[model samples]
Target chain A: MSGNNDYTQIDNLLREDRMPHIWCPGCGLGSVLHSFLTALNKSEVPLDKVSVVSGIGCTGRTAGYVKLDSFHTTHGRAIPFATGLKLANPELKVIVFSGDGDIGSIGGNHLIHAARRNMDLTVICVNNFIYGMTGGQVAPTTPLNARTSTSPYGCFDRPFNLPKLVTAAGATYVARWTAMHVRRLEKAIVEALLKPGFSFVEVIAPCPTQYGRKNRQSTGLAQMDYYKENSIIKHGADTKDVDIDLNGQIVIGKFVDIECPTFYDLQTEILGKTFPHMSKTQAEEASA
Target chain B: MSRDGQLVGEFFMNGDVASAEGAICAGCRFFAGYPITPATEVAERMAERLPEVGGTFIQMEDEIASMAAILGGSWGGVKSMTSTSGPGFSLMMENLGLGAMTETPCVVVNIQRAGPSTGLPTLTQQGDMMQARWGSHGLYGTIAIAPSSPQEMFELTITAFNLSEKYRTPVLIMSDESVGHMSEKVVIPPMEQIEIFPRRKPTVPVDEYLPFKADADLVPPMGNAGEGYRFHVTGLTHDERGYPDMTAEAQDKLVRRLLDKIELNKDDIIILEEDGIDGAEVVVCSYGISARVALLAVKAAREEGIKVGILRLVTVWPFPDQKIKEIAKKIRAFVVPELNAGQVVLEVERCAGGAAETILVPHMGGAVHDPDVILEAIRKGSK
Candidate 1:
């Protein structure tokens, strides 16, 4: 491999030929993917044993671009797929990356349950607050009264407080950061990668063509400026206080970081005692 | 006992339990499912056995997740499976389609129940024959097996995993609630004796590996997720390299091959039980629980001096088209007895091609057809 052809340090970690990605102009997914690859590099997690999974949406495209063992599964089904992957092969580290609509809406049940069961996975939810791939439809995380193709009259329903939901559902590690905080995003991902149990880092990204255009933050810079002006980092704040409204102060920080027996720990503890001669694989210590 | 979880001695067990044991014997190490009537025993049995035999059994939130997880498990270097009844089966269709598209090797056991919206949750029905064949959105070929009894359930669950592994696609065991609930003797042989088909591991090196590229047998060997293969698979149409190629040509190539893998191998995949079909005037064609009923009916008709035969479909999908067409030439009529109105009969009729009269002995759930009803149909068909 010629160093001259390698454009970036993390180029080895990505499918460069697949780039010029599908994310539109000024979309924040590019920055998010960069930070993710950076984290994967710095953490030194064996890329061979790392399987990246994603659901449908713009963010879901991350699985395809990653040079790791990847699976671009059906819409809203990435969590379950990752759960199976991790459980079936306890040695592999599974990561789920998808959009707000994919994880917060259609896959809401799976998201909460994975956290509840404390499945060993690092979930990176790229929340642009709109379904950018499908022409900017209203998302579950879209602010109430936000304009979208579907919510033309404005969204009447309240949006999901993702951080609060996952924390309550029992995530051992949880954090939120916008795309502008690339360094911090990369750091948090590294931390989440190191931490076992269900680790979630929600990356608030920009959808220039969709959410930004509809919600009046039309350009990618506009969304970054909003982040620049309104962002407040208060570590360990009450998750309930982190809900972001339209043009609201973006409370971005590590919200929940605690110790808990993960799905594997509990499985081993409980099953090892009962089935004295059980196998050492992930599924060996399971049942009900 | 030496086989760890394989029970070789004769034991009276329900078909559901036998299936769970069969999965264990067939090298399935991961099971994920949700509880549903009649089929719940399969999950219950799996829960007890998987832990004992060093496998994973998870009760997922629902069937869709159950199906998705199994696919994930399969890629994670374990043979995986999920079992459900009617409602759960319908919920699983989307992911099942995804499983087919990605060519993931997994087994889905749908213990048939009455449905059209939970029609008869506690009862048996062969209602999902068409759904099993065409429930998924796109045009993809399906491999479905119909187990008639507890013994067959134990035997065929192994076959389902073997077929799924051989083809690198999800295989369905379409047994009804009656058969799923029936208790009978299931003799599991020594593990060394059972023909086990391991996952086809990729022969090519990592850089040269194309995850979706078919080898000589039209099935690309699979490489596990963490093996440095670093391959990608998607629900979208993809090329040989496992990268998405959004074009009509790409779709045509992928779908046709995804289909031809099973279609071309139909002779190897299709299993049928034919008795007296060589010179019978009328053929009693059936599968699953209905086939059990059709057998007695055929016997009764024979006593009445009617020339009839019994053709029980063991492998329901890739539907014994050639065999059906061949039999149609000599038979006066084909008597199809299914718990549903007419599902597989349509395929029988299509294969028969007006060569023989096609008669459907239909039952609309809650119960199996009486032998007398099928007997009357067979007697009339022969005349």
Candidate 2:
């Protein structure tokens, strides 16, 4: 099995028996998974040490396909679940991979709080603009005036600028890339994986079956072309200035990177100072 | 260094505090909860003590997140628990179903208070008894243990953790506000004397392991998140391999196993205490604080030369149906007194199966039953 030519590199990281996956033909989720696999392969962290968590949605299925310790948690709960996983075993590299509605709308509170605490988690959010799995419901990331199942008249609410949300919430590292930018997205993922504190990467992906068809980008290829034409690589750009518009210029780049003490570090420091007589492990163990 | 060793001692404390200590003694190392009245002391105690014992205590944004965190913590290879009262318990229902579906081992302590919607935050009520059994949406079996006093709260919380680990399901410590806030002497036995059931881990190598495959005992060996087992856990109906299988057949198989894991083990899970039940004319059935009150009523009835017995339910769910059936054959009737208008009495009535008359001495929350009222019911049942 070691020298087998039958298996592809990406295939080694996937649950081959579980494929072909549930994703529609030409869905951007496939590309996102590929980029994640590529990044995992490139990173120095051991695959065995990685744990992936996801909330309910089309993207939530990513945890099921990945041949790693993964949790397909309840809707709007991936971040908190990952927080618990990481805090319980600090050695594990916990990552939350879910859709826009999952991470931005219902789970928005956890996202901000996890980022605010600077919990060491890698959050890879696939922003498909609409809630694809629930049949194209309007999401928090649905661009203004966009058509959705719920918003047949057009979405009137302004969409959240995710990079700005996490930046303000105190994420140490943040970046954005399109699913079509496979190489760049993979690189961003690798960088996010290696970063110390809470890191977030927003991947702008097409939901051809849901968002794309409803909005006039009809085919996955058409959405990819739009991404290619509209995306502007703006490293160090202000997150607040990167709000996406329908078929408009998509500002994509690494926007924030800084150093700060994480939740675990601060907690340890406080416990150590408070209990001077106890060893670090003992102090940590006292709560168990 | 050994936190478990430090747990052996006697202390006079409230039920909520004793419960937190019980969780630690039971080898629970992770606690995630939101602070709610009556149950908040459990979280406060955990926050103060967990770090000292090499454990983790996290106060999540809400009960929903708290429930999710404990499930994640369990998968991360820790015995996890969370506590809440009525409102927070309601918020935790959805994720509680997820825990059941995924077969995660964790404990949920509901220091129950009066509620249709937070009617009485500081008052005692067994109103959430039915909710604990069926709060989470689905047809599933659940384990809930009722503790009558602070000492029982300490003892039964450990039982809750042990049962959760053994069955790989969420166990509920269905304590009420009266017991939660009341102080009493609780003796923590030496660590070695207390039996703790740790989750079963897969013996097979990573390649051969199936995440949802159950042994003859109807429980799957759990694989920790970062242990290289690389298993997938989902709330969706899944095959033994843990991959989603959305078919009626798959749902039937998965749901049945989830139910059977506890149902088949019902004999072991049901815990009840009885006094003077043999050859009794009337048996008073009750649980939680009401059980203590019912015992006094039984004593009053017996003093009046009435043949009455007391059936105290320690494990409220898995409902002691067999015991009720056996006792119903010899008894003329059952008198159930509860804080709620009617809850567990329905279960007693169902199990009696017309062999005996079932009477409910109802109380509309905010207080325990007056012994005279239950005594009246016992006297009525005897006649």
10 residues in a row with least lDDT, candidate 1 chain B = B1-10
B1-383 per-residue lDDT for model 1 (tens digits):
66576788898999999999899999998999999997999999888888888898899999989999999999999999999998999999999999999999999999998888878898999999999999989889899999999999999999999999999999999999999999998898898899999989988778999998899888999999999999998999999989999999999999999899999999999999989988899999999999998878887888888889889999999899999899999999999999988999999999999999999999999999999999888878977
Quote fnat for model 1.
Answer: 0.88
- lDDT of residue A77 for candidate 1: 98
Show where candidate 1 strays beyond 4 Å. A1-8, A277-288
C-alpha lDDT of candidate 1 relative to the true structure: 0.92
Candidate 2 residue-wise lDDT, B1-383, digit = tens: 24443466678899999999899889888999999998999999999888878788999989889999999899889899999999999999999999999999999999999898969999989999999999999878899999999999888999999999899999999999999999999898888888988789899988899989999988999889888888999999999999999999999999999999998999989898988988899998999899998877888888999998889999999888889999999999999999988999999999999999999999988988899999999888988
Docking class of 1: high
Off by over 4 Å in 2: A1-8, A276-288, B1-5
> Candidate 2: lDDT of A25?
77
Top-DockQ candidate index: 1
Model 2 TM-score (B-chain only) = 0.98
True lDDT of residue B36, candidate 2: 97
